[model samples]
Target: MQKRILGVVGSPRKNGNTDILVSRVLAGASSVGALIKLIRLGDLDITECDGCHVCWQGEHCAKKDDMEELYREIIQSDGIVLGTPVYWYGPTALMKGFIDRLVFFNSPLHRGLIRGKSLMVVIPFEETDMNTVKPVIDFFDRCFTFLEMKLVEKLVVPGVSRKGEVVTKSEKWLREAFESGQKLGSGLT
Candidate 1:
């Protein structure tokens, strides 16, 4: 069977730089014969994880919301591409919430569900320096490691503030994102 890749856009702004980058990545993945699905978290009604520890008991989350569907998709996917815009030197609130909910996959009972899966992170920030996105990178690094997932790639595009600005100002970054997706789809990373 073909590999399935899921791209999750965590930016609240529709058609923002993060979303454009993710769309390009998914397009590249599709070009390489990988099945691609893009999920815009901003459009979903995913609630915050209640810290109930119900999933630790081998039971599903107590809340009924869009997260349940996302959990299913994540489990079924071979790889995941997470894209977010840097806000206050960190990932947006939507991204943070999504990451928090991922605890279910890391629960003791489902410990290995995410093992061996691949992950790619794309972050866009207004800061001109690449260092500005370091915190976000570090966050994902630790999270992915905890999940026993492979951190395949990290693409950080700097100096993009306005919507659609990346398209004109950061063509190279866009190409890099596409190439990273191609590599992931080809299983070369």
Candidate 2:
């Protein structure tokens, strides 16, 4: 069976910079014969974590929602590409909530599911300053480290504010994103 790559778009605007970059990455992965699936969080009903430590005790999350299915996808994927736009110098709330619910994977019972899996992060920001995306990258860095996941690549596209600007304005970064996906796919094989 072909390896699976899951792309999660945390941008609120469909077909925006973040989504386009993610699609480019997934396209590259597909070119390498990897099965690719993209999920837009803006279209889902994922809720925030209630600060309940039940998952830490090897129990399930207290709430029932789209994340149950997302968890399954995450488990099935050989690689995951997380795409998000910067908001207030950090990842969007949608992305943050998704990350929050990832506490389920923190439990020793489920930690192994994520260990050694390939991860790619695609971040698109409006500001010209690269520092604008630092917090977002840092958060993912910390999370991936704690989860024992290998962060294969980070495609950060700065100075992109409008929808599809990344595509219209920068061929270099777009090529980089595709290359990162190729790397992720080839690495898995």
Candidate 3:
């Protein structure tokens, strides 16, 4: 069976660096026969997590929103590619909200739905210092670690601010992103 990869773009700017990078990764995955789907959080109606904790009791979240569909997609996907531009040394507000909603999977009843899935993260930042992206890396490391998900790859591009920079000026990083996707896609099979 072909592996399914979900590409979630957390950047609000469509066709921006994050979006392009995420698409490159998905394109790479597609080249290897992996089924890929892209989801732009900016286009969705994902609300902030209400902290109700109802999902902890094996019940669905109290708030009805697009997250319900996201849960289903996540459950069906064999791998995920999460791409976001850095905002205030962390993920964008859109990505953060999506991450918050992922708490539903923390429930023991739903943990199995996410454990062992492959994950690839793409982070593009405007800062020139490599250390500047550490917080973003650390944040994802903790979350995926706690969830028992295998982090297959990470493409962190620093010093990029303007749109299309990844494609225009960062050929090396773009190649790395594609290779990361190839590696991730091939590994699943």
lDDT scores in order: 0.91, 0.89, 0.88
* Local error of candidate 1 at residue 149 (angstroms): 0.7
* Candidate 1 local lDDT, 1-189, one digit each (tens): 588999999999999999999988888888899999999999999999989989998668877999989988998888899999999989999999999999898887776778889999999989888778999999999998989999989988888999989999957988998999998887777
Clashing pairs in 2: none
TM-score of each: 0.97, 0.95, 0.96
Worst 10 residues of 3 by lDDT: 180-189
Model 1 is weakest, by summed lDDT over 10 consecutive residues, at 105-114
lDDT of 2 by residue, 1-189 (tens): 578899999999999999999999998988898899999999999989988878777657777889988999999999999999999988999999999999899888789888999999999888888888899999999999999998878888888888898878969988988888877766652
The TM-score obtained by model 3 is 0.96
RMSD (CA, Å), each prediction: 0.9, 1.4, 1.2
Quickly count the clashes in candidate 1.
0
- TM-score: which candidate is best? 1
Ranking by TM-score: 1, 3, 2
